[model samples]
Target: HNKRVAIDLTLPEHLPVLYADFKQLRQVLYNCFANSEEVMSDGGKITICAQELAGERLELRLTDTGPGVADDDLKLIFKKFFTTKKKGIGLGLPVCRQIVRAHNGSITLKNNPGGGASIILRLPLRPLITIGHGRRTNRAA
Candidate 1:
């Protein structure tokens, strides 16, 4: 955890609540942040922006000020075991994609026009919630 890696959050005053698996979502975020931190070893900025989309979905975009992914590798960024890091086994982005899909959401990565990379995650605002055996579960609405 580098204290120098600053996170700037630009969010709506009132964001819609999401019915999601907290642990899984947290892990996804951690993976994204870790990747950014690793690439910006000297420290950089991570900007996070969130907004509601047409009352049907929530969009969260995370952008980092590190060198963006190579154009040739963009297609394989979320593939399992495909990594640019010397020590990475390449499961991070794949796992993140799986988690996002399971939540009935979509995740995408793109290089910024000026520099760095941006990851966009879009999820439904209202997920179908069901209770069974004293446990709650969410599904695509």
Candidate 2:
């Protein structure tokens, strides 16, 4: 498919540093960008935006100019082995969710009002803290 697609990736001058595995986080981003490209097979623009949310969280949202996801399928997108694409194994989103969870982050999806879908991922800026045995443990730094 020789479809012409335009990508607009925007990052601010400053961002909150998040603690996450480089490879896993890269994979998640690749999956999202690739999915947007696939959905806009004919040709469309994919806009990726990043911002710093409250509580020092990082928010990244990818919105594509393509057909949006069905309401019924929205909830299942993150489920293991679920997908709407004919050739997709459906493991991409699931793995993304798993990796995000491991980093104490969250991934969500929604349909854009005009058209296409939006994938939102939030990552914590600081390492997670847990208390066990009367001791505070930092998961990652």
Candidate 3:
């Protein structure tokens, strides 16, 4: 890829650990980064900031230097099969929301004052140890 993009990760020195599937969480991050990169076609800086919320939550913010999405499209961005890109089949943000929810988290998008789009993902500080539905046992002994 010859595209020039800058990514800045602004995270706490000692980040708290969460129990989650490495692959799934990776996909979530990947989608966000890819989305930001796609919007900034001509090379722009993407800032990733993370903070610990007051209510035992983790907030991850991905900000890009591309023109922000229209206000009308903000609400529809996370909707399945919705996209502003020419080749985008849409599913990216929708899947991101779903994945965040699975981790008992949330995702939101808004426009930055200067320009560009800011997407925030808030996740629980204490996540479930396992990622599957608990095993059901027949206790009728």
* The candidate that achieves the highest lDDT relative to the unseen native structure: 1
lDDT of 1 at 16: 85
In model 1, state the lDDT of residue 33: 86
Ranking by lDDT: 1, 2, 3
Q: Which sections of candidate 2 miss by over 4 Å? A: 1-3, 129-141
What would the per-residue lDDT of candidate 1 be over residues 16-125, giving only the tens digit for each residue?
89877889989988998898888888889999999999878789899999999999899999999999999999999999999998887999999999899999989887
Model 2 lowest lDDT segment of ten: 132-141
Q: Candidate 1: misplaced stretches above 4 Å?
A: 129-141
lDDT of 2: 0.87
Q: Please, what are the lDDT tens digits per residue for candidate 3 over residues 38-141?
A: 87778999989998887477889999998889989997999899989899899988998898888878999999999998889888777544434874321221
Supply every candidate's count of residue pairs whose N, Cα or C atoms clash at under 3 angstroms.
0, 0, 0
TM-scores, all candidates, are: 0.89, 0.87, 0.86
- Residue-level lDDT of model 2, residues 10-97, one tens digit each, is 9999876777689999999999888888878789998899999875689999999989899999989999889899998999999999
Q: Which residue pairs overlap in candidate 3's backbone?
A: none
